[model samples]
Target: DAMVIQNPRYQVTQFGKPVTLSCSQTLNHNVMYWYQQKSSQAPKLLFHYYDKDFNNEADTPDNFQSRRPNTSFCFLDIRSPGLGDAAMYLCATSRTRDSIYEQYFGPGTRLTVT
Candidate 1:
């Protein structure tokens, strides 16, 4: 049995190094999203992929990018991580926009910069 999973629930990154966080789901959903949630703040949408459509937030920085090669997987590529980039990265999924349009999130990948 396979399911949506993110390796290393916690990630320690440097101030200006590149890091890649990954996500995979088994629900066979078509829409996958990545969000950055800071302390007591809203989880801001960084980007997402509806099938093959890659949507990025208007204010998202160039340092943040994503890739979804297939339906079951998506990856968040954080290039040149900054101190501000340290936060909880959440991965969510949904089949179609239904009443339960709610997305299922992972344990979150916490990034720490030294």
Candidate 2:
């Protein structure tokens, strides 16, 4: 089955603290990405790894980072979460340039700032 998975479906973070969210995929996709979706708006790409080739979105905040150690695992690291960081963090995957831009998304990690 094609599926992307994100753990702890929800996360509560304190201001100025670091937090990390994890993602995994069973789809064996070559491209894996981390995105921040705030306030039901369009998902913003933070960064992604295409089979070890990392690409970061220019508009992504410096406070956000990501890594993909292997094909199946990826992570989103927040150096210091601000109040504005409270939002749904989505993990997505797609076959490398499969012609279709469609991506499979996980349930997402909803981060709450306290």
Q: CA lDDT, every prediction?
A: 0.88, 0.91
For 1-114, candidate 2 gives per-residue lDDT tens digits of 668999989999899989999999998889888989998599988888989999998888889888788999999999999999999999999885658677899999999988
- Across 65-91, the per-residue lDDT of candidate 1 in tens digits comes to 898999988999988998999999999
Predicted model with the maximum lDDT: 2
Alpha-carbon deviation at 34 in model 1, angstroms? 0.3
CA lDDT, candidate 2, residue 30: 91
Deviation of model 2 at 79, angstroms: 0.6
RMSD of each: 1.7, 1.3
> Top TM-score: which candidate number?
2
